[model samples]
Target: MINETELIEQLKRGDDTAFRTIVEQWQDMVYNTILGIVQNETEAEDLAQDVFIKVFEKIGTFKGDSKFSTWLYRIATTTALDHLRSRKRKKRSGFLQSLSGSGGEEKEQIPDFHHPGVSLDNKERAAVLFKAIDELPDNQKAAYTLHKLEGLSYRDVSEVLNTSVSAVESLMSRANQNLRKQLEEYYNKHYR
Candidate 1:
C-alpha cells in the first residue's frame, strides 16, 4: 500500500497513475459529500469531476498540516457550495425574469432526491429527510451531512469545516432539532 506521503509526492510530480489512484481511493467520499449537499445525482457526478480537477490543479498548495482526506473534503465541500450558490442565483434570476413577463422559462421542479446510500425500505424516509436537510442553514447542513451521512467523526468534521468539534456538535444539535420540526410539519401536513 502506498503511504500518503508517497502518493502526495507522486501527485505533485504530475504522475497520471498517482492521480488516478488518488481519485479511485477518494472518489466515493467526494461524490457523497457533493451529493449530500447538492442532492442530485447528475450534478453530484459533474461536481465530483470538478473536485478532482481542482485537486489536480491545486495539489501543489496542499500543506501536510491535516489528513489528506480532510483536505480533500474541504475542497469538495467548497466546490459543492459554489455550485449550489450559482444555481440559486440562476433560479432567482429566472424567477425575477418570469415575474417581469420577460421571455424567461418556467422554473423546473426538482424531484425529491433519494440517496443512493439508503436502503430500499428507507428511500422514502431518506427523501423526506433530504428535503429537510436542504432547508438547513449551510453550516448545520454541512455538519450534519458530514457527520451523520458521511460517517465522519466530529474531529474530522471539524477539520473539514474548519471549526471546533464543539461547534460541530452544536451545529449537529440544531440540525437534529430542525430536522425534527421539519419532519413533524411534513407529517402533519401530508399524513394527517
Candidate 2:
C-alpha cells in the first residue's frame, strides 16, 4: 500500500490509480460523514460522490497543512451541508408553488437513519438518539455529529467548523441538553 504522502503526490500528478486508491480508502468515511449530517441514505450517497469529485478536482490546491483525512472530512461536511441547504430551498419553492395552486414535487421522506458502524443490539437506541440529533440546531447538530457520531475529537470538530474548541464545547453542551429534553418528551409521550 502506498503511503498517503506518496499517494497524494501521485494524485497531484494526475495519476488515475492514485485517485482510485484514495476513493476506495476514504469513501466510507466520506459517506458516513455526509450521512451523519444529512440523515438520508440516498442523498448521503450522492453527496459522498460529489465530495470525492471535489477532492479530485481540488487535489492540486492541497497545502499539506493538515492530515489528508482532516481535509477530506472538511470537504465531506461542507458538501453535505450544501446539499441540505439546496433541498430546503427546493422544498420552500415547492411549497410556494403549491400555495399558488400549481402542483409541485412531493416532499421526500427522511427515513430513520441507521449508522452502519452502530452495533446491531444498539440500532434502535441509536435511531432514537439520531432522531433527537435531527432536532438540534445546525451548529449544535454539526458539532455533535462530528464529535459524537463521527468520533472526531473536539479540536478536530472545531477545525472543521472553523470555531474554537470552547465554542464546540458550548455547542455540545447545548446539544446534550436538547437531546435529553427531546428524549424525555418522547418517552413521556409514548411510555406514559
**Winning candidate number (lDDT):** 1
Total residue pair clashes for candidate 1: 0
Worst 10 contiguous positions by lDDT, candidate 2: 104-113
Candidate 2 residue-wise lDDT at 41: 86
lDDT of 2 by residue, 134-181 (tens): 888878888888888779999999888888999999999999999999
Tell me which residue pairs clash in candidate 1.
Answer: none
Clashing pairs in 2: none
Please give the TM-score that candidate 2 achieves against the real structure.
0.90
TM-score for each model: 0.96, 0.90
Error of 2 at 77 (Å): 0.3
Scored by lDDT, model 2 comes in at: 0.88
Task: Give each model's whole-structure lDDT.
Answer: 0.92, 0.88
